[model samples]
Target: MFFDLALVFLCIAAVSQFLYFLLITSNHKDFVKRYNRDFKEFRPKVLLTVPCKGLDMGFFRNILSLMRLDYENYNIHFVVESESDPAYESLQRIIDRCRDDMPAGFAKVLVAGISKGYSQKNHNLLHSLRFAPHDTEIYAFADSDTRVSRLWLAHLMYPLRNSKYGVSTGYRYFIPARRRFSNLALSSMNAAAAQIMGKSKYTTQVWGGSMAIRKELFEQLNVANLWQKSISDDLTLSAAVRNAGYKIRLMPRCFTVTFEDMSWGQLFEFGRRQMLITRVAYLRMWLWGLFCLLNHFLGVWILPVAAAVRFAMGENDAKLFAAAAVIHWASLIYRTYMRRRTFEFVLGPYGGYVRQLSMWEFLLNPLWLALMLALILISSFGRTICWRGVRYRLNGAFDIERLNR
Candidate 1:
């Protein structure tokens, strides 16, 4: 009787979760259409700060995509730790070739020197902000590794026109560099994360990779003061904005693409670092994420396990377990399909570039789920993480001790 009740409960949860996914996915599609139709033409003077550490995969291509942005009247400031950093020369070459076509003072690389208290990326961004032209209206930030669309800046900046929106952010969608198991698995895991973002204030956190804020509000909130001792830029900023009673706007059309090829070792390191950062910087979201992960694991596995146990006991209700498994799996698969369709619409032309990504994301969902659960579990204990060869011990959200460079 207990087993029967549990199976019924699992099936009900699976169906309810599917319905929830359907609602979010449908809302995302509608958001994409509405944003493109209504918010495509807001251009303001902007300062785009991109912090660089090392040569990431497709570094040159990613930098070139930024140079080719469709927006007008914006300056790109690429900041590195020092002139000796490998990415510095690469940025210079790209600037040399493209500066002629851009407006005068279009792109330049600045040296931030070594970080003293906080992350080097944070130091670099703070250094770059010091040079923001007084006329700059919007302060935009991008990561060095992701490739953005031509309209990325325009789309990212539009929502900030409203005073109620504190930050405008976009998430990354990884495209596998090779059709290998680990790369595809990482992409699928990341895709699952990217799908969860929408208009939900509870779920939306600012992603520093592709986020922007109004210059006036940025100074008013004193976000740089918050980042001065912080290891994380986005999470710190997210908390500040939320505390000020402002909403974060997640732009569906502004999702950036990253090309990646990770071995299993590299994948775990990356995933663990990300979750660990979230664990320390934003514990509430981390707890919420853990709940979702547990919910998903139980919703999918309870029936199969129940069915196997019943079959081993030679019980008749084993057939009932099998039927519940079919409904649960089918609902999950259809939800996955609808989510992918929503992403295709969000990505627009770039959708064609991600060949076989949907298939891999669907086929490898179970593996990624297990891997992600393991990552979150592992992150729950760690306070130290190494990012771009710099190791730091996170004492708390606002206290960071640099262990090494």
Candidate 2:
């Protein structure tokens, strides 16, 4: 009786996940339609701030993509914690080489010095804001490792023209620099997170890698003061926006691409750091994610084990459990394929790369989920996280203790 009951619950969860996947698919289709609408005349004086630490994969190409944005009336402020950081020198070289070919605005590197209490990325961003021109209307943030399309700025800022939206966010999609197991595994895991993002309020969160907020809303919410000691800019800002009774619009066209090649250790560290941050700052979201992880874990791992045991016992309903396992795995792979299609619609230039990634995801999603479950379980017990070689203890969402600068 217990076995039968468990199987019933598993089937319900599987159907629910599939329905949720369908909902996100519909939301993505709406997002694609929004991408076709023109926003050429809605240019706002924007400040694009990217905080850098080390030299990421394809760092030069990523920075160059920022310099080549097709928008007008915007400036790129690349900030590093110190001049000693490798990215600082690279930023200088890129600006020097691409000055004549840049768009309407200028690109310059700023040194934010060392962080005292907050994460270095937040410190760099807040420091650069101090130097932003008084006339700047919108503040945009991107990560150093991401390569964006020329229309990234245009699409990210366009939604803010409506007063109801508090912030606009774009997520990152990973492309493996090499087709190795670890590289493909990390990309597949990252894609699983990215696939959940869409136009719905419940599903949208501020992604600092590609997000924009108007200056008026920024000051009204006192985001600068809010971010003073927070470890995560994107998650904290997401909370602030929602608390202030504002909506975050997910912009599909602004999805940034990241080319990555990670070893197994690096992959584990990256995954753990992200889960730890979410666990510390966003408990409810973390709990929901944990619930989803466990559901997927059980469906893929536990269900198969139960099926094998029943089969060995020569049970009559063994085929039912076996069929459920196949359905769950199929749902995961089908959803991944659907998500890749949505990405290819906007990031058209990387169509081949996204296609290749989908193949890896189909093959490795079960293993990826298992690794993700392990990362989530491990992260549940830690408050300290290391990001970009800096270790800090998270006291709460806003309180932080930096162990090293």
Candidate 3:
């Protein structure tokens, strides 16, 4: 009776949590249409600070796409470690192209020199901000890996005009043209993060890839100091925003598409690094995520175990176990469906990219779920992580020490 009762509870919990996850993912866009903040009326003088490293896919195209943005009053500041960096030449070409086609002061390329002891991106960004115009009203940050659409800037900046939102942010959708298992698994991992960070009401996580913050609130929170000491710039902004009692919003229609190629080892490394950072910055949420992932995977197989046990014992509750198994599979199927739907909603018109991602993503979605368990396991055991091939060991929430190889 105890086993039977436990099995029943497991099924119930599985279905309930499944529905809760679905509800959270569904809310990613439920409010996308209602926000009416317009960027044109404000016409804020925006400072776009793009701190770049190695130029990945769409290097020149992504940088040049900024020229096509619909917003009128904005300055593009592309910061790099140095002219020696591979990305610098592409950035200079972007600057040269802009100067010939647009006004003389439309774009500026700043070099932060090279740093081996501190975070290079932070150095590039903070130095660039020091030179920003005093009248700069907003700061826009982007990653070089993203392909931003023309309306990306407008959408990301629009909602910040509303006083309630302190930061406007958008995430990236990983789209792979090839259906390699590693690529599909990475795409799945990104989808799961997008739902949690962008959709869930419990927390409003911001992404640095595409985000905008008002200048007043930024200085008011001492963001520069925070960035100087932080491991993840986006999470630092999130912590600061939460401490200052402001919400970070997911901007509608502002999702950037990322096409970075990765192998299985690279994917695992990336996932582990991100989750370890979360474990450092947001311990409670990381614990909760670990528990949920465990429950989700283990709870999924409870019925099969019970059914096998019943069959072995010639138990009379065979039909009950079968029904529970059906509900369990149904719930998992629904969860997979909702994940695809989330891809479509957050990706907007660009969601077709997922369709081309992997047929296995549809038929063998469970493979990614298993890979997620592996991701959680890998993250659970890591103390140090590599960034741009440099190793760093955690000292605290915002501190790290360079690890000797």
Per-candidate Cα lDDT values, in order, are 0.84, 0.85, 0.74
TM-score per candidate, in order? Answer: 0.93, 0.94, 0.90
* Residue 44 lDDT (model 2): 92
Question: What stretches of model 1 exceed 4 Å from their correct place?
Answer: 1-15, 38-40, 103-105, 308-324
The numbered model that scores best in TM-score is: 2
- As for TM-score, the candidate ahead, 2 or 3, is 2
Q: Compared to the true structure, candidate 2 yields what TM-score?
A: 0.94
Decide which is better by lDDT, 1 or 3.
1
* Model 1 poorest ten-residue lDDT run: 32-41
Clashing pairs in model 3, backbone N/Cα/C closer than 3 A: none
Lowest summed lDDT over 10 consecutive residues: which window, candidate 3? Answer: 29-38
TM-score, candidate 1, is 0.93
lDDT of 3 by residue, 330-390 (tens): 7667656666665665565677776665355667665667677777777777578897766
Look at candidate 3 and tell me the lDDT of residue 319.
62
Residue-pair clashes, model 3: 0
Per-residue lDDT of model 2, residues 184-262, tens digit only:
8877787778777765566678899999999999999999997887999999999999999999988877888899888
